[model samples]
Target: MTDKYVIPREKIKQLESLLNERDIDTLLIFSREGSDPILPFLIGEDTIHLGAALFNKNGRHIMLTSKSDEKKYYESGIFSKVKTYNTSMAEVFLKELNEINPGKLALNFSLEDAIGDGLSVGLYMMLEELITKDRLQKIEVSGEEIIRELCSVKTQTEVDCLRRCIQITNDIYDEVFTKVKCGMSEKEIGDLFVEGMKKRDVINGLGKPYDYPIVCIVRAGLAHRSPGDTKTIPGDIVIMDFSVRSEGYVSDIARTAYFLKPGETEPPTDIQHAFHTAYKAITAAINEIGPGKRGYEVDAVGRKVIEDGGFPTVRHSVGHPIGRQCHDSGTALRPLKENQDNRAAERKIQLMETYAIEPTVIQDGGLPCMLVEENVVIREYGAEILSRRQEKLYLITCE
Candidate 1:
């Protein structure tokens, strides 16, 4: 089945309306080497270098690229007008801007949010020189609102792609469990997982090859390290954190396994308790997710459970939004302070938002870490777990 999730024209219209409300007469996104993740929003494809997307309040969208990139953008069929340049396109870009005659211009650079700073320091300097001091003075640059809306709200097509990715990821987890063995090395297992995913044409969902099938915490004492040559022995706790991508949509999931010898006792009581606590925390957080809920509120449910269970909370945020990138740009579900106002955070968690809530708990002894992860979508009523296989604990027995 060819995955299809094309954003409706109306969604762009909504974005235009938002720009008007913010008094953003024009939004210009410039990136060299396609380093910015936001490029996918305007170009609809990943093959672009030294390009700029101009969006006006009147809903006019134009893409400018180097002549070498003309064929790639032309094939995408997403842009209405594709401007090509053989030499320095800055002059042509400036002329285009003058024609639009926007009162204010917004660029993706923010000190507060890294997502807003897609423009590298060097690129920003180059842009300043191209526009000159006078035109630069006319432009007002800020990052708060535009980047957030572009990434947070899922377009219908994006939501569908995410949903499918979650389903495929869950299927792979089930298949991997069947091949897991106590004597296998961590690197061997990680390799097998990658091979299996490739058979399905699902590369690392997180957009980077190094992070693909990122089976960290393969054995005890290396909870957050990358998959290595560690051997899996009896009583060893195997933790796998991985995700798969489809058409740039990402789904993240993590699972743990306990290897048991022929005559070994069941998993340690403390380990089981910690695992269950982490599971409870994850489930509670998912239950609390929906429209009109703050990110911190959902995060609190998970953190409190770990704390109450006599274990230290996981160091990272409870969860993050997953999208075109593994950790998409959006509000994260973390604990809130007593004096902080979370109204804006809550507003961002609208229906169709997808998040990966991986609740982890570290035991006092620090021998092992209990981790569980699932991808879910926010609906009008509640959250839905998209990942298929929900692994509480895998018991690998050696004969």
Candidate 2:
């Protein structure tokens, strides 16, 4: 199929401005079997996964690949120029560097963001040796900020892909809710989700399939645990947190289901209260997001709601940017706690960025944990909720 994604030229221009401002004369992004995340944003294709893209201060770019992958690179029609090497990629790479002779070169490496740290230490050492042998200028710096911005900001095509993936996840949940019984085990319920994704020809956005849909059977603690054989019981609240990957984009969503006790038409008052409080928290947090808003400020809006509702504040962030990865790198809606790394939460939210707002309400005395997660896109005025939100709990009728 022909590629349907493109990094808008305007965005490329902005990236060039950022490189110029940082005094980075050139950037070198190397990928081995699609290891680097930033390569997809620029190349817009998965046909040739092994290659290198070089971008200069002028926003112009070139692609270098082996003879085997050169045809696909030409088919892409995205790169301005393409160079093919027969035997020695090292020789071609060294020749390119000598020709450009950049004063300051940037590579994909970061200490703060894991997504920007794709370059391996072993490869770095090899590159250093080559540069030293050639007696070339070796001013190397990390291109974390540039890669972060490129991956965080969504193009129209990316936004559409995310929307489709979210809709698929919603549909799967809607179908699973109708089939789930009061006696079903958590693992059984997770199997239904796996079948749904397979039927729809989609895959889990992150992590392995065994734990992708973190199924909680009336259990409370950390949110990343795997689903177990615990069977669903009456008066229990089950939380299903999952993500879907499609077209190289991801959507994260979570919903809670409450099982009705025998002869009971609805859940207990305490359960109802916890569910509403979590829903309210996520709603308020999403409303607080917009262009130029700080991440911590938005997090406080949701955190306060949970506190006022007589529940313990969640240990994790209220929300985080979602895109190429489930927890994509960018500004995060989190508190600036003392002696903690809160730099991601201190930055201002950018326009066209997407986030997953999840507010958790943990009850004391072994009561069920309530959590509601929703996806949103940062707009010029405010945030737009992309998922068909879980307005109320999914109540299960029991015999």
TM-score of each: 0.86, 0.91
Q: How accurate is candidate 1 locally (lDDT)?
A: 0.74
Model 1: residues with Cα > 4 Å off, grouped in runs: 1-14, 45-50, 66-68, 71-80, 84-86, 129-131, 206-219, 261-268, 336-348, 364-368, 389-391
Give per-residue lDDT, candidate 1, residue 274: 71
lDDT of 2 by residue, 42-114 (tens): 6654424347777888756777788777876676565677888876577878788788888878899998998
Residue 262 accuracy (lDDT) in model 1: 68
lDDT of 2 at 24: 90
TM-score of 1: 0.86
How many clashes (backbone atoms < 3 Å, residues ≥3 apart in a chain or on different chains) does model 1 have?
2
For every model shown, the clashing-pair count is 2, 0
